[model samples]
Structures are given as C-alpha cells and as structure tokens.
Target: MTNAHDHRADLTASFEPMRHFMILQSESDVRVLIRRLLLSCLLIALIAQLVQSQDSEINEIQVGDYVRFELRGNTYQGPVIQATTNGRLLIVDVSVDDRKSRRQVKREACVRLTPAEMNSVFKPVPPASKSEPIELTMPTLAEPGEGEEIALTNEQLPSVDVSSPTVLDWSGFQAGKRRINKVPFDADPDLPYVLDISTGTVVYSVASDHSTDIFVSTDRPSDYRLVRIKNHTVRIADTLPQHGVALGLIRDETDHDKGLCVITGLSTGQPRVASAWSLPKQKVRPLYCHYRRLLPDGSVVCVYENTLRVFDGRDGRLCWHCPVPAFFEPAVSQGGRWLAIAANGRLFVVEASTGRCAGSIPNLGKETMQPCFSPDGKMLAVYGENRMVITRINDGRVVLDHQANVDLAPFGGESLWTAPAVLVTPGGYLMDLRKNMLVWKYQLPADVNEWMGAPESGWIPIINDDWLSFVRIPHQDVTQLSAAVDQNALVAIQAGDSLRIEVEIKDDVRGDVDAFKANLTKALESSGYRQDISAEALLKAEVVRAAERTDHYINFGTGKTESITYRPFGARVTVVHRGEELWSANQAGNLNYHIAGGLQRAAKQLEQPPANLFQTMQLPRRFLSKKFQNGLGKSSVSIDGVK
Candidate 1:
C-alpha cells in the first residue's frame, strides 16, 4: 500500500470501467473527487477497523490496488473492484472468469494486498466454442430459493363472477377543455401541486389577495366563495417533485375553517408540523413529497428524503418515523396502516407505526415506479416500464402481473364490506373484479389524447394549455377491473382476420421475463409489426436461445489453485415463424448476469447481425418478419397459433 502521492498514473488502464474515484469522509459527509480520466467515480472510504465478511475497512487505496479482508477467521485478497455512492458498500469481483460474479462487503473488511500475492495468479477464463469443448467439472445451478427477487403473483385470482357494469361510451361523455375557475393562479403558481383530489367539492382561496375559496365534494367545482385567514409573506423553495395520488389531499373538516393538511419547509427547512395552513398556515409542502396521505386520526404521513414521517394532522406534529432508502415517492394506504415504497429497484413494505421493514419484492425488473396501496391496505399495485404488478401486503404475494402499460393507472380497490366492483382501466373498461371480466368497455374519444382521473371527484379531468375541463362520470359508471398483465399489442389484420403470437420464455436465461418481453416488443414494433391483423392468420414467433444449450463450462483444478476457468457466458436470439423455422442465427463469454447481458447481445444481433453470420442466415439484416402480404405488398393476415 502506498500514499495518495505515490498512486500509479497507469492505474486508469485497468480501472477504466470505474469512471473515477472520490474520497469521502467515513460518514460520507461530502466527497472530494479524484478523476481517473473520465471514468465513473468510485467512492473510497478509509475505515478505522476491519470486521467480518459482511463489513470491512479498506486502505487509502486507488484503482488496481490489491486488497485483503478477513472474514470468519480467514483472509482473502483480491484487486479492488469499485466503491458505491456513499462508500459504505464495496463491490469486489472474486472470480476473474466471471466479471459479473462479485460480492458486496462493507469498507471495514478491506486491506492492501501483499506484493507476492499480486504477482501470483493463474490464467483467465477463455472463450468456449463447439469446435473445442473444454470438459471440466462445474457446479450445477442451485434451485431458486424460497426467496425470489421478483415474486409477484404467479396465477390470477380465483375468477369472480361480476355482474355487468354500466358503461359510459366515450362519445356519450361529452368531453371539452374549460377552466372551472380563474384566479391570478394562487400562491407559488409556478410550482403547482402534483395533484388535487376532491370527493366532489374542493376548498380554494379566492383572489382577494387575502382570502381562500371552497367547493365541497357534494358541490360543483365552478361555485366558489371567499374566507378570511392569516397569510405568510414568505417565498419558500421546493424540495421534491409531486406524484402518487394514492396519498390524496390531507383535509380536516374538524377545523371547520376548511383546514387543508400539509407539511412546510423548503430546501434548508425541516418539515415541522403536518397540517393545513393559510398565509400563516400551510398546506402540503414540497420539502415533504413523492406522496402524502392523511390518516383517519388526523395525522399525515409524508416522504422527506430517505425517511417516512407521520405528522399529527391537527397541528402537523411529527409522530413515528420509518427509515428507508430515498426512492420513487412512497405511498400510504387509504387506511394509513401500511406504507409502500421502492428502493434498489424493488418494492418494500413498511409498517408505518413501527418503521419495521415487512418484506421486499424482487425481480419486478431492475427499476420500479410509483407503487400504490389498495384502499383496504391489503393489496398493492406497482408500476414499471415493461411490467406492472399488484401484490398482497401481508406476504408480499403478487396479485397480478402483466406487460407494463403506462396508460393503465391503479386508482382504487374494493373495501372489506363492499363488492369488488370498481377499477380504472384506461382501455375503456367497466370491469368487475368479482366476475374477473369486463362488464362493459369503451374506447377513449379520438379528440381526447390523454385521460387522468380527478383525485376524488368522479370527474375525469383534462387540460390543454390554458383550458381545463371536468368530465363528469357517475359513481356507477366507475368499475374496478381485476389486475392482469395487459399484454395487448396492436395486431395488423383485416376486418375478417384474427391473430395470436405465442410468448415462449426459454428459461428466461436472462432472468427478467419483463425485459425480454419489452425487448421483443420493441424489436417487433420497430420492425413495423404490431398492426391490426385478421382472425384467419397464424403468426407465431418463438423467443429462444441461439444454441439451445450451454456453451459455457468451468473447472476448479484444486484447492491449491485460486483461479476458475470458464468460457464466455452470453445470450442468443431465435425468432421462429409457425412450425416452420427461419434459418438465421447467434454468439456469451467473459461475463456475468448471463441472461440479462445475453438478451441485450441477442437483441443487438437481431437489429444488426454480424457480417459473417448474415451470409449464412440469408436474410437481409431484418429484425422481424410479416406474414400474408396484401395486393399492395402490405402484411395482411389472420393469426391464431402458439399461445
């Protein structure tokens, strides 16, 4: 180990992948970046003492520094890989054969490598091919554990027999954009609140430059009145973006003064009390955001950075606090008993009162978005780009899993005493979850581009620049649809055609079925494929590997040898049309996350095949194929095969 002054200039050659390095204090208060070219920053923290494998300390080391750490009475040294954001976690690749094969340990378990150990190493894993089989013993993959990273619902709920629900044809629902009320845009108009929900009526401050306005859920929103209250002449800055309406407005009828629940504080300010305020009082504040919901007890739970805090609704006093990594905004249950948050690309449930982490959901993809709790707080719906999920809270069981559709919004769920009869299906469905089917459905009006439900009022609101309109919908017209994967793709067919494309997941070698689906869909869409088709054509495409078998094997010579030799671990792509297959092919090696990376490689090959393989396949570098061309040379066919 050497001082920072003696750091080698050639270190960047071996650690270019790690962009750069930053030296942050133990607490990571602030970072001092030391650039290693234009590389990714590796946060380095010099810990005081070394501990077990789970946690350790490291030297004032740089890239290419061989470091050792003690765990369970044994010491293991490996070249330093890289440090994470806060320098609290260090990712070390123990096996040279597998770049993805690494482990995360604390900074305390790290020490510098000896000169002798650094010089003594074996050969790296070589690429594998059918021409030369490297026969060697390898450990079989372990069975997936009881703990799956992403375990959403595996099957649909028991089919419920729901009655036909009243349907509002998009046409019958006259839609227009109109401003309900016009005022000099209230306080801080530029920083609009993320959402505003009304059971029907809402309370707004009038433009007396000193008064407020109101419209109760039972009254029309256009009707406005003024009320007197204190005002604050302060310009506070915003801290968080507004999102997640699951945690609706915090309203208190108790104060009678039409009290609106909120949290105050901008950048430097801390969220003190959580309640409504006039000029002297404040409504929900940006310092505490992502999502905020009111409890029956007049308390409000708000997300402020990495912590979830409950503020007393009456006076906005802080109550219990739950600590979780700051992530996409957090949502509180309508009942206020459970809290839903996303961190590290997974959904985590928290016990609001105890701040105890209940369970973390895995494999909903590597990135998760706004997660909403059902009104009853028993089931939850999580959103993602490629997949959408609804799971139960008690065991974190998935209630529904489907291809992700940004249009579908998770609004509300059935209450304990009520029938499961309401849901918001953006595809124009008045579905009955109890019946597990659509009672009535309609399509969006051609004129309306996007539709968003009002926080509470049965009104579906729309706005175009200066205009806004409240499209009224009857409560009976609202129906809750059962959670299911919306794997709907626009089929290209004629008036008399039908279509079906089989979804085959050969081992999900990539581990992520959603990502695979997304990739395939993207390739298909980009290839001009997802257009409407007729009922007579059979369009079947199989998503399988190129080789259909393992091209990788590993060998560990003996306990005396520290190296493991294996070939490249990669992914292959094969798109089959009907039982008839199209002759076209593949190529993984020197990698980990075999399936994920393989999928990427396969997709790339599909888009732009290697020149040599392109010669053998005989297809002019095309990603997808269309069946049954019309008189105009257009793909017009009916598909029904390979489900």
Candidate 2:
C-alpha cells in the first residue's frame, strides 16, 4: 500500500470525490496515503546519498547538476544541484498533458547511499537489525478493538439492554437517531451507530444477512451504503454536509488516572488523530469512559465510570469534571442544564455545570426506570413497577403519580422479568410542581406498545412489522419547519389555482428525516408555492397533501380545496381564448411525478399556438356542462365523438 510520504511528495489536488482514487491504494484511502508517504521518504533518502557523494568529492557536480545512478537495480535521476540542509535531493518538473508529450512538476529526490556506493565513494552507512518491530500510530476517532476506556462497577451503572446472546434480525429497522447494540461477550459492551464525518458515511453494521453474530451483523462493508433518505427519496449519506465526523477513544498511555480521551472524525484522508486544538485540552483529560451522550447543547456529555466530563460544543475540550455517584445512568435535560442519575431506585438531579446534587427523589419501590426531563427542564418522570412517578427537578417533591399499566407486555417477550418499558410521551402528561396532581395526557399512538416499547429523550419508539407502511410518532420534521413551508402555502394553492409548476430542492443536513421534510417544505414555499398548513404555533407543521394522479380534477371551492378525482390519463389544463381551445397538454400517466422546471416553459409553448389573441373563454363541457350532449358555449365542448 502507498504510504503518506508518497502522497505528500506529490499531492497537488484536494480529496473531494476521493473514491475514484481507491484503486491506487491497496486497501482503503489510508493505505494509498501510506504508500505515497513511503515513496516520498525513499526519494528523500536517495537524494541525501547523492548529495553526500558530490560534496567535497568532485567538481562539475555543482548545484543544478543532474546525475543518474543505478541502486539495487532501480534507476534514480532528476535535476537537483542544491542539497537541502536536511539531506534531501531537490529537482523541479512541470506538469504536462498533451498529444505528444508531458512534463514539469517540481520534484525532490532524497538519496541514501548503498553499501557499495558508500565504500567506493563515501563513508558507509550502518544497517539496522531487521527483527525489531516498528510501531505505527494511525490516527482515528473511535477506539478500535479496545474495551471501553471508562470503567464502572455494575452497582454504579444503569440497567442497559444490550440485546442478548440470541442473534436477532434487526435489518430494515430504521435506527432512530442512535441505536445501541450490546455485545454477546463481555469484551465490548456497546456498539452504537458511528458517523464518519469526513466521508459522510453513517458507519454501522446490520446483522450480516447471513451472520449470527451481532458484531458481524452491524459491519459496514460497502463504500457507498445508504444512510438515510432526504425527503423520503434521495439517499444522502455520501453528500458532503450529511457525512458524520469520526470519533475514537484512545487511552493515555502516559497517564492512567485521567482515564480515556475521545477523538473526533477528520477528512484529512491521511490517517491521523484529531489535533489537540480540535477539542478542548482540559475536557480532553482522561476519565473512566462510561457512556457518551450527544446533548442538545451540541456538546457531548461523556459519563465516566466514576467521574463526569463535559466538553465544548464544537471541539472536544474539558468543560468540567466532577467526582460523582457510580453505576448510574445519566440523563440530560432538554435545556442541557441538569443531569439526572438513577441509583438504588432513587433519582438524583445534578447540576450539569458542577455535578452537585440539586435535588433527590427517594422511596421508589422496585428498580426504577431512568428519570425523564421535560422539555422546559422543570419536571422529571420516573417509572416504577406499579406506578409511574413525576417529580420536580428543582425540588424533591412529588408532582404527579399514576398506576403503571400492569397489562403492558414485554418487548418481543424477550425478558418479561425486566422493568416495564414505560415512557411519558412529550405533551402526554401535565405536571406542576406547585400543584401535585396529574392534569392531562395527549393522544399517543394507539399501537405504541407494539412498537419499540417506551421512549427516551430525542429518540422515539418505532415498531413496524410491515415493510410497506410505517408510522412514526412525534412527527420528526417539525423542528426546522418555517412559514414558507407551513400552513400559509396551503392557502395560496387554494387562492391562486394556477397551473403547471415544478421544482427540485436540495437538502444536505446531517440529521433525522423529519428535519429534511421541514427544509424541503420551506424550499417549496420559498419558490413561491404555498404549503399545506393545518396547525398553528408549531416549530414545524406536518403538511399532508393528497398526491394527485396524472388525470385528475381538483375542486378548490366552498372556501376549501375539497378533493381531487383521477381521470383516465387524459386530463390537461386547457387555456381558453376567443371562445376556442387555445392549447392543452396531457399529463404523464407514469407513477413517478415529474416536476417540470417552471411555468415560463409551459406558458411560452401555450402562448404561441392556435392564434386567438383575445375574446371569449371556452370551458370544458364536463366542468361547466351537466352531460356530454348538454354542453356549454363552444361547439367543440361535446366530449362524445369529439375526436
């Protein structure tokens, strides 16, 4: 494989669309980079040898003098007279691309002397032993093959469902934001979806279509595997913006108490660890690596086995670290200010900045499900065996309580003995700290229990056995929705009733599908079209419009756009001028909707035909007439035998 030295010796271009160069590398792009580096190193060594042979040894061997030498059966020659201080042979060449000849690129050759050459012309260089192994440090974001850097005892950890020993088929399941898969062996407990920011690849493994091992199942073997669809159609993993940054956990071989450090992904192409400036030097300190959370604040909260470390939002830096409870699962507030830890069926609300317990909820029976923080960061919901409890995060007071649904079945009947997968859907329950009473519950998906059980923050429970139709609750795209794509557009479509408009929008955001929908809707509105709107005051409104078939009649009347009826592949928008059918074009019956570029194209074609510049309008008999025989003003209005 080519090394970094070879590539650095001759890297005149950027690494965009790097896949095309993969053939040059032995394995992946990294190997190609290595090969390049090695080649450059060899050239430098060769140049140095030549320079020494010329120094104080001969005239005419001056700077700018070119020499050719045969060493170990390989010929080495390039124009280079000046010897670099570091013992490199320098040459210059220009790039050439033509029908006849090609040349010219500034080239440097570093020469190392062979034993024969040294004996005959200069001092002999010593040879090193071949048996000694050379250690190579390849930079990466996540720890490869190593166990978790942060260690915690079982007692200080949250009950995590890492799946089980049985290899289950989870292919085709849409991994919500983050999917956690446990290892069957104790070696590596967790394997989550990893995003490679540099390449824009959502690196993950599916149970190999034929494998029974979880590790084997979730492997990424393809270079351009589909990550997620943009606006429900176009695959977007390979796009520049949607690519994930790589991360790796590396232990500080020098210090042990500091624990482990996390490295972020890079696009350098040459394998290298993240630069220290990429993250904060302080937060980057070592700690028992437990679990890492992508917080709403854009910073990651990495819970150590014993300590809690907070880093900067952009770079991984030490924001703060505090000694805290062990064996606890950490939950962050939506506002990112407070963290809740569950231990011994009790809840401890800790200030995220200081890791000090601000409040505690005690006397919980049986093991407690992790506590949930409300969007406003005031209330927290804790699920117990028989009753689900809600408490104020600021104070240790019970705000609301309800008997847990005892009839709830276990997830896939995997382990009925574990705690019930209970979760409080957003907008589901109302809890007020001042008044301790359950107020209201929103209508959740009726079959939510059938899906992936209960919910956690930023992740929704999804269960769909059917391949064709799937339902997602807490409709994802609303967060980035705007007025341009919101309900205002719905009113415009009704008001204008214009004909023939089409557009293609592009989105390259790295996030959930909902975010894409919101952006697309906005783009549509920005292009002067109204979006369907039915709700008010939502971050993004879920716009649902019936997709009309090729031949269809749309009735937007009675102050509403009522319905659309499909015709037999012949319906077209006709313009009436001077009591004649000026022009009409048939809609393509193909299921795939082809959005034409603009109204100007259609308008230009329609305006040049049939030549009736003014006067009356001809309406379709079916639109204005009661029947075929009973028609309107124009004689051509009759449908039967009209052709």
Candidate 3:
C-alpha cells in the first residue's frame, strides 16, 4: 500500500477508538466526570425553579376580596366594596359626614382609596345574617413593604332600604309674586335658581324651608351665598356659597335658551363681545386665539376671527390654536373639535384647533345665514332663500335639502335693535340630532320698532324668531324604547313581589317577528317624555307582567332555535307547544288555567277601555289588559280546554 493510503486508514482507526470511548465510559475517571457534570446542571436548574415559584406569589388584593389600607396613619378595614371613576371606594360602614366637626385636610394627590381607607358615612351596611357568624381579625397599620397580612370577615349590617319618594308638582304649591334680582348662577339639579340677566340677580323659586340646597361646587373658591330680596331689601340667608363665584351663564332647568349662553363683555375690542368661561370653574380667558367651538373632551372651542383656539375648561388654558378662512360665522360641537361655519353661499366644516378643512357642503349661490348645530354637533342646518339645507358636519354630505321660503337675509349684519327684519331671518333652528328631526324655529322677530315701542315692563315676545322655541317631535321616545324591546315576545312586569309576563305568538310567522317587535315597541313608549327610552320604567314594566304583546305569548327562557317537546304530544314545534301540551295533560296546569279563566270572566276585566283613559296614567296597564282580553276572546286555544 502507498504511504498516503496507510495514513488515511490509521486516522480513521484513531477516530473510531475516540467514538467508542465517548459512547462507553469506564467507571474510574470518565464515568465520574460525567456524573459530576449532570449533577451540577440539575442542582442549578432546581434552584432557578424554586426562585421563580417564590417570585410568583401574589400580594395585591384581588377584586371582591375584603381588604384594608392605611389612611391618614389610621388603618380602616372593610370589604373592598365599589370603586368610582374618581377613585373613591364605598365601604360597608354607613355614617354621616360631620362637615362642621371633622378636621378637614385637602390633598392634591389622586390616590385610589382602598375599601379600608374610604369614610364609612356613605357605605351601605348589609343586614346581619342569622346563620353562623365568622370572626375576621384585621392587623394594625404596618409600614410599606412590611410583610403582614390583613384579615377581614363579612359581618351583619343594618338592613335599610332607601328610595326617592314621589315628588309633588310645583304647580300644586301656592303662588306668590316676589321681585327678584338676576345674578350669575350655575346649573344645579338640587338648588336650581333662574337668573334674569337684565336685573343681575338670582330668583330662588324653591323656598329654603321646603328644600335644602344640597349641591356643592369645588371650582369656586368661596362658599356660595343664598341671597334673598324681600320688600326692596337684599339679605343673605343662612346659606353660603359652597364655592367661589365662577361667572358664566349656566344652562337652566327651564326658561332658558338651549344654545350656549355665554355672557361675554367688550374685552377683546369686539363690540358687545365677551369671552366664554368654563362651566364649573367659570374662569374668564380669551378663546384659544379667540375662536369658538366645543372640543371632543367637552371643552369649548375658541376662535378670534381667523385664529382658531381650543381651551381646557378644567383649568383655563389654550390647548391648541391655528388659523383658517374667516368667511363663515363660527360654530363648534360639544367636543370642541369639529367646527362648522358658512362662508359665502356654501357650508364648511373644519377642525377647530388646527384650522384644517375637514369637510364642506358646496354649490350654493346665495349668501347663507342662521346656521344652527344639531344637539350632537354632527349636523348643521343652513338657511337660504327658497331652500333650507341640512348638511352633515363631518363628511360634507347633504343629509336633507328642503325647499321653502326661508328668509336668510335678516341675520347678515342686520342689527337686532334696529331692524324688524332681523327678527324673521337668519337666526337659528332647534334640532334633535339623535333623531335627525327639526324641533323648532327661532329668529329675531319682525316689527322691531313697533314691538319695542309697545308699552311693556320687558319686551317679552310670547313667540319670537330670535328667541329659541322648543317643540316636541312625534314619537321621539320610540327611538329609545326600541332598544329595550324583548327579542322574544315575552317580558316580565313586577309590582312588589307580584309579576305578570305576557308572551305573544304571531299567526303570521313571516311578518310576526317584525310586526310584533314594532307594536310592542310603540306600546312601551309614551308622549311628553324628553328621551325615547326610560330604563327604569322598562325594567319596572318587565316586573309587573303588564307588558303589551303583539305575538302569541311572552317568552320565558326558550330561544328561537331551542325545541322543547311535550311528553304526551310527540310533535315538536316551538317551545310554546310543549308548554301548552304539558298543561293540557297535567291536573295542576288544568286547575290553574281554569282559575285564571274564571277570574277573567268574573271581573269582565277584558272589556275594551277608551284610549283617552290612558292619557293620565303612564303605563296604561288597564288599557293593555282590555286589549289582551279582546285578543284572547278571538282565539279558543288554551292549555287544557280551560276556556
């Protein structure tokens, strides 16, 4: 063999011996080394695993757990009850806050109070259970990071149910004439006071003896005062301003314009122009570059002619500003972001702060006037000669274009004080944006000189174009009631513990679902309700079993797809078939069905009642009962031939 071939074979042979040695190690040196390496690795792995396990321990209190936290160096314990958006927690302890005696301390920090940290005054204590009582011991306050566990146990509390009593209408109260002054006031649900701007004083219609002023505002620095005017003398009553005076026009409970009521003075050289103030704080400041629009965060949009501005109401500050075309009269939405204005004959919607053209409604030749925003600020109603346009603010889509003789000239720099024409033209329209319906028309009334000359204490136009008018739109409540309509024809109505649920099955299966859904929807609604849906009334109606039905029966738990078969009756139809068949066969069902039938006959409760009878009553349950009885009379089908 050649030397190269010999060397190759020898190298291969050497590698074979090394491979064999690696595969099978002898006990003395190699085996000992392998065992030592594996043992070291396993030990390291075990330590790592144990470390992870210890680190995974949860120390924070979970939801629904009773826990406590240290507040003002005192440890208070209660069920980690409920949390509010403001970070206040509701505990089980109930006590009244002693504003007079309690040493008050204000903290600027926003810290979530644990159930234990919250005051006990507002907590609802549950009634004590008669069952076995468990003892829960809580540890005293400990320093942060100190490893200590606090234990809390559920305990019996007082059983008290609080509710709002039926309110007596103010119309029923005796009327007495008293002169009052107008002053700056905030809109309060409790102490609602209306101000007449001309007098610069407040009118407190509600007597202090009749009702206590419960509302308090933190925005104003000084305590609010309740001033009374009697016999030409003004005196401050026992009431004091809970907060300082934040001057601005507030939305009134009634007898006020719905549009933004900003009282601005000649501050920025604009004649009869005043700066808009924030709602709660009422701090006066120039609009972000003097612009007017509402921001998305519920702040007002400020514009000064060409300059755009956005201000934060919580604290008066310019959030953002820019410049854009100044041709149109400015309007901002509630959010203060989207702004709509009419330039020349067309409409333009733009970003309030950036001054960028978001959208536009074009192709009009006449100069537009009197642009009114829908409640949501999503649409604008533009008035013109011979035609009125409703334009979408965001996309520039013309939602509605109604042609009519709407005078648009009166609002174009026509002085409300000088021209009677200003009263009839170019003012504004009241619109319900949610329903996309026009509710009222407003403009400065015509015959200004004649009407102003008329002898009167105040030139109160019983109806004026310049003044806003609110008219009810037909069936507006249907929009809200449609939301609560039962998918299955059944709804539960309850009174105390008594419940009546009526389910209806439509004879016309194809049209039944839709027709019944619609009829039930209308039945649930009533006229004069501001909003469409009343969740409380709907829930109450469900409990009383007085729910009107357009279909066969009120459904319980049965779904459309679910099938329940009666034992004796083998046929499978809707779930109602099973209930009917089962009742026909069972003795208990037969007895109950007959009893109900006899009651219906004895009382003649099913007799049809006049529609006008339902005007005074809210639910019209009696009317519904009569209608249901008429329906039942037409059909002979019953659970056990009880009819």
**Top of the candidates by TM-score:** 1
Residues 520-603, model 1: lDDT tens digits: 444445434452344233333333334323223232333241222332323444434344232222343323322233333543
Error in Å for residue 161 of model 1: 26
Per-residue lDDT over 1-643 for candidate 2, one digit per residue giving the tens place of the 0 to 100 score: 3234422222212112121100111234888668767865675565456545544121233333333221111122221122222223332111111212111112322344443343233211111112222222432222112112222222322222212222212222443222223222222221233232212223322222111111111212221221211111100011111122222333343422222221222121122222111222235555444445543333445555455566543334456654445533455554345677664446666555544455466624223233555544555665544344566544456655443222111211111111112233232332222222222232333333222211222222221221111222223222222212233222211211222222222222122334434443443344333334342111121212223333222233333332223321212233222243322322222222122443233333332212221112211111111111111111110111111
Tell me which of candidates 2 and 3 scores higher on TM-score.
2
Candidate 2 clash total?
76
Compared with the true structure, all predictions reach lDDT values of 0.33, 0.30, 0.27
lDDT of 1 at 61: 37
The better candidate by lDDT, 1 or 3, is 1
Number of backbone-clashing residue pairs for each candidate, in the order shown: 78, 76, 61
Candidate 3 minimal-lDDT segment of 10 residues: 582-591
For candidate 3, lDDT tens digit of each residue in 282-315? 2243222212322323344433445434543323
